[model samples]
Target: MDHWDEVRMFLAVAEGGTVRAAAEALKVNHATIIRGVGRLEEKLNTKLFEKLATGYRLTDAGSDIVELAGQMATASSQIEARIFGRDQDVSGPLRFTLPISFATDLLMPTLTAFRANYPDIALEILSSGSVVNLGNREADVALRVVVGGASPPENLYGTELCEFHMGFYIARDLACSRSLTPAWLLGANEAVPTDWAPDAGIKMASVPIRFAEMRSQLEAVRAGMGISALPCFLGDADPLLARVPGGPVTHIGDIWLLTHGDTRRTKRVRLLCDDIRSAMQGFAGRLAGRFEGGASEFL
Candidate 1:
């Protein structure tokens, strides 16, 4: 039995509390995990865990081992990074995270172009609203929307990508009615379309026809439910949805690219960032309308 592998199994068991959970994390069989733990105990000549009906609990010695194991894991990761970092070619998996809406719209096409340019680089993208932890190695890069100037950790680097443009949109049928003014659109009598708009002021006044996700919100609008405030990308893509003629345009947020300071210097990361920055230049018109004036101030 490999001592390091056994140590890793032991650490996983300690962190996960159950052999079943550890096995799942390690992508190994349950019996394999149990055997690994047994071998680790035999090598150390001490019982590290107390088996229970539900799971396992660490002994006094196990607690000490867990801390050491954590350090070892960190060291191993650092070594692996260093080894990969030495290669001049941009190879290996690059984990990226971004907001779900942005991923589907702004970043997807650009990412496709990047992959075409660098076939050697494997990309793993996680489209989620939840922020990923860079320090913990959860993601190599992240894109976020910030209302104010963002201050990432000193060990991390960030660059402003673009400003997100937003405005009220309604179905062509609703626009034809000529009663879709900002005051009336979200009024008590008017039907509110479910988008990311805040439920205050006009939003509070109206009765929401449906509260839904991005795709559904656009669908609802196309179905002529009501008016909704949406990002420019979504509105521009749909011919059925028309931007309110003269309404309060909002600056939903600024898009930023964030990466660990150490990773920023890497060729793969630098290349990808440069590509994204270059692609975002085409969105100047949309960004300008959102930021050049007090667009988001109404909210």
Candidate 2:
């Protein structure tokens, strides 16, 4: 009880069911976990875990502290949220979580400009497909593409940046082939149907190939592997690719610049949100799928 850090480690191991699992979750060495838990056990004078063939099992004493430890964790997060929300300074670490594809393909310019304009703000990007829990202070802000422009979760607040339009794109040269049978290239993480880049209900194509990531899928399309659906901003910018001749546009969703209500009042967070909204304005045409082929209206 005297060592909060040790109790925290014990809670992690208990929740994760193994020392190694807890270590990975906490981003620490398993040996460090062992040491922490061991110290905690000595401090409390009781054994907390019993290792079985399956995994670690909490002993009576460990079970007793689970609820208390969980409460402690929640209280810690609440304190962090309140303090961070009250911070008015324009300079500090600002963690933003967003989709990997957006980060790699469309966000560099906006992020770079934000950094340049706010040199004191430490920008951190957690670019992945997974959503970071803002309520837990895992990230200060999140950029998400949701099904509709309206109705965000109760805890979040933001403006809808733009509607993200997706289009079936094929290599410019390949689309011109008279006898060509286009195959589908899709993201492996997509549902088995991969309807986002569907065959448009008319097909005479070869089997599809799946890539683990969007960049790989984009590269495959660029290499003329087959047709794929991409955000207009990405596909339209590539000179080698074009929307499939007369293909119908797909509305992926509206991009929302969301921050938990707790952090919305923070100066840096609000400033970054404003910058992103302004940047999105410039690319409104591209996001709406109004590509001019070789022209530069989005510039």
The candidate scoring highest on TM-score is 2
Model 2 lDDT tens row, 1-299 = 46877887888999999987986675455776888899999998899999898889999988998899999989877987788766988799999999887787777888998889889999999999887888788998898888744445534565667888977777766655535666788777553334333333335365778887788888888787887777888888888886765455778788888887667778998898888778777778888888676412110
Worst 10 residues of 2 by lDDT: 192-201
- lDDT of candidates 1 onward, in order: 0.70, 0.77
Tens digits of lDDT, candidate 1, 102-177 = 7787678999988998998998989986789987888888877776554444345677667777677767655565
Native-to-model Cα distance after best TM-score fit, residue 186 in candidate 2, in Å:
2.0
lDDT, residue 248, candidate 1: 54
lDDT of 2 at 201: 35
Backbone clashes in candidate 1 total 0
- TM, every model: 0.57, 0.63
lDDT for 147 in candidate 1 is 64
